[model samples]
Target: MLCIYNLQLTQTHHFFHSKKGVPFADYQGICNWLTRLVQIENGKQLTCNRNFIAPLCELCCASSLQIGSLMHAFDSVKSALRVLEESVALNCEEETTKSCIQYLEAVPWDDSEEEEIVKVASRLGPIAMPIVARISPVDLTATRNVFLSALRFATSSPGGEGSGLPFGDELRTSAQEQIEYMLGEDEETPLVTADDEVRSVARAGLAQIFSSFQTIISCSLSETTETEALHIVSDLVWMCNVLPKMDMMKDFVVRWTEASIVEIIEDNRFESIVWGLKVKVIEVTVKVLEAVGYGTVILQPTLRVQLLRTWLPYIRKLKPILDAKAEQDPSFGHRMDEDLCQNIEGAIVSLILALPSNDQGEILAGWMSGEQVKFPDLSEAFEVWCYRTKSAKRRLVEGGLDRVGNGNGRIETTEMRDMTMIPSAMVLIADTDRKESLAVKGSRK
Candidate 1:
């Protein structure tokens, strides 16, 4: 009831400020009332009650209040911070801790002040790890700390204790949002530098996520409810999204295409717990492959092949099913928009063009034989692959050669007396008169 009243006061302040012409400072009486929620008397501290704990948290809340510097009494309030520190020390209720954390996160450190905020954040130790991520953008130490913390929740067991806890979900949700926002989610371009140091963070995070996924995957889906299973699927999708941003797409392909995950994917019984998960996995795979194939996410030749061979079958079978289902459906819950469909198709075609002819032939043959034939309609990749492979010799002869620089032919062979005869070959010819004379003499001889 006290927590509810505390929230109502903030709402009441907003109501007067927005509706009436009064400023937030007009609520000075209310602010002073809430500020005293945490106090000490007779050489003893108050605010032991859970209800007052949240109200004390609310007193220090409102980033705008701190930013506006209204209500001078609430401006430099340290009691809330004291309560928060004590709460963390006591390992208090999740709601109180979360509210305190939220209040700290809301503080306008960069805009208003930082001395006290940084001190509290540092004193809070690892519990304030996520706050450091938001408050300090260029602090790699804080970024790495948050990344490690994010990785911990990212790799947590699906049905573990944290899975059911309110604060645990907050942490997990914070983990997801922090990583994305830090990496530049809605921005025009990625904010991540992906430098050597950042890559190291990604590498370590990748290793832990792999180990956690591998461990949790061995547990039967029947052991978890649909919600829990979906949570794990969401984490895996989160992994998929983060990998491409960090230039770890190829690394992910190597791990996910391994037999352990394949066994789960191949077991496509409709009623089985794996079905929903399998579909979502393929959805993320399509996006991953799209990134890799479109060159947005660069990868080596080998991992591209692994991605195609492992997920192509599923992509082929599921594209139509995805098209048939609405996002409102429980079974196929994801929204596969038209742009996504085109992207996957184009990406598949791009990858197909990169493969050897024999492999393309095998993939195309399987596509033609199954119900998947008309779904992905890889005829774009198929037709292009055939023409590229069959006309390889002709195109090579016709397209001629690229002359990057006029340099001496390293081979020193006089076989090419007429450079025009080998338009197909990119023989680097140094424009040196001596080499040309030597080639002519050698050919004549």
Candidate 2:
């Protein structure tokens, strides 16, 4: 009926344009021709023929600037923009697309002119977002290339400043919504790997998106913007391989803390981001312990007593991993069993020998009376114990130290002549705070 006749009329319009030397009287006539031609079902095929689209391209390109300017006279910039959008859409090849973008970019902008484009782009953002999602996976490499180029041009071009228009915001949000939709796909989906050109494009796109997130977090205006920025940061942090490069992320962790970010990393959500982040808690703890010795921090005797009585049970769970190499090699395991205790005893012997002989009684009395006993030398003493234990393990494996069989599952070593060595290591570490207290008291006196 009417629909079939209208379709035939559209095809006839395409046939008219496809022929060479077919000329329209003017730009209005050219637009009218294109309007009829666009209604053709095989318009893409006709346009692909090059000759068919020559008149339309001539209209879109040759008079693009004048038509854009004329667009305001009829209050028809909307139609101009639509035609430009359509002209680019029909010629889906790279060179044509580039020419189309160049023409649009070259369009003259005044306060009123740019405002209209920003309004249209903003209204189009949500519609473009869903379209990108639906079609991304089928041809990710091609889609990503186009998207990356568009975003680059959107974010980098300079214009529309002080024009009472929010073109920058509209362009940024619209382009970002499209990029985010592609990246938000399920993990199981296979990513497109077309060729070197395509991957290079994808990498550049991901880097730009990641940089945008970083810029947002570091430079955002307010709390709400920062929160949105954090969401973006969280996404990149989880998706990328970031763990090995710890220092690069320190500022991000500090920002998270300052921003009062308290969310625990869930098992699945942002798993990559979480796994990639350097362990902030462990890094902070080690730094604090180094600057302020063990006893002055969490290991102060009052806390140490509680921690040993309570937390040691938890810490023991980690011992197997720490002790893995010692047990794996039986020769080494046997040597550790034979010499560890005596090696520890030798360190204590050297330390006790160096102490003022008469002060030994005072030290003993302090310990016996339950007074605050000081271990000024505990740090060096602890280092020696660790070294000796590791060395003994190595020596047993090397057949340098003898081992005695013990039925218990625990690796039993030969008994030291001085059994006090084991308990003294703990005592020295626990008593380090008392030495600082004594120094403070002496200074006051």
Candidate 3:
């Protein structure tokens, strides 16, 4: 009995001190060491080699099933976050900073573990949101970004888990507010300085957030939300303005323009701000025109029609506004000082010209005759018919007046000709009238 008890004691001692003398370890053994490390009295004493931890994480994330076995991974990560938080709080020594980084390194780049980190960080987002929020280092932008990226990845992946156990719908709106907080409020001004994969991933996450704003703008019921929706639209436009411009991304611009036209302007709610709103429309119109002229193809024909269709009615309305206002001011409404008129005219002309040339005259003619066609304002239509008549006359003069010729090649030779010369006939009639008047005056004399 004494011999058996002594053997058991020796075995237990050997098991507890197994890692004391080992210089390096196999991957599986490192996890067991990590599991045991958490239980140690002085957990910080065991030096964590990032080299071993990182590789082990890579191997674990590569297997989907291993995630279930590593559920307690968050404990170590939470401890690391605590160290990081405290360091930031104390603004401690450089050595403490080094130790904080070491702790982070040991947390592993595994997707599952990274996801767990995100779960903890999400609570910080809305909780940290304060009244009259301001962007600053204290906002913890980097950590927020890291958490967001991980959260998005895990949620979107085919079989990854995240903060909201089975699934989360609020992720979109929540993520949107968090990012918009950083972007709009200027918290830490997250710079783009990473490789393509990282940068693309980040941009995609941001786009998703903005997409939520698009939804709100679409579904908003109240005037206040509608106005707020416009502000959000402005934020999105600002984002597009600041980012690297791409041809493919013009759809968002189109959507934004559509929303502006339908939601804000069409209802005519803000009548006082019509001019400002019109100016915005004009700017977007110019962009669309340039895109069309340059042969940038946006797939939505309805969007093209929606934007183009607004032009004529808007222009005609502007004519009345200019005329009414001009009646009030002599200098300000000087006929030649028609900047708005010119812009509207130029936009219509460019848009028409951009369409096939044949379409221009036809649509213009319809517009002139009040045919209610898909294009051309009444002014444009009248211009078209007048130009067509003058063009025909010019052709008749250039090619003998006996007949008019067209691209069809030949005019009929048998066409009727005028018996009297127009100029000669007019002169003869005038002379006869003068002679008769002279005869009558002589008789009176």
Judged by TM-score, which candidate is best? 1
RMSD of each: 17.7, 22.9, 22.4
Better of 2 and 3 by lDDT: 3
lDDT of each: 0.57, 0.38, 0.43
For residues 264-314, write the lDDT of model 2, one tens digit per residue.
232234333332121322232223222122212222222222222221222
Q: Candidate 2: where are CA atoms >4 Å away?
A: 1-146, 150-165, 186-189, 193-195, 202-445
lDDT of 3 by residue, 1-445 (tens): 3343235434433443453333334446745555444333333444445554443332222221222332333346555454334434435344443443454454454666566445534543442233113222344556555645743552242222343654442453355345444444243444322234435654664466456554553452365655544444444444443332322345444554455444435454444333433444444445454443233433233444455555555544444554566588655422323454455455455444333224445646545665343222335433433443445455556767635543445332233112111223323333453455556557879
Greater-lDDT candidate between 1 and 3: 1
Over all chains combined, what TM-score does candidate 1 have? Answer: 0.52
Q: In candidate 3, list every pair of residues with a backbone clash.
A: 364-381
Per-candidate clashes, comma-separated? 3, 7, 1
Give candidate 3 misplaced runs (Cα > 4 Å): 1-230, 236-244, 253-260, 268-282, 294-306, 322-347, 366-445
Clash pairs, candidate 1, are 407-429, 407-430, 408-430
Query: What TM-score goes with each of the models?
Result: 0.52, 0.20, 0.32
Indicate the residue-level lDDT of 17 in model 1: 38
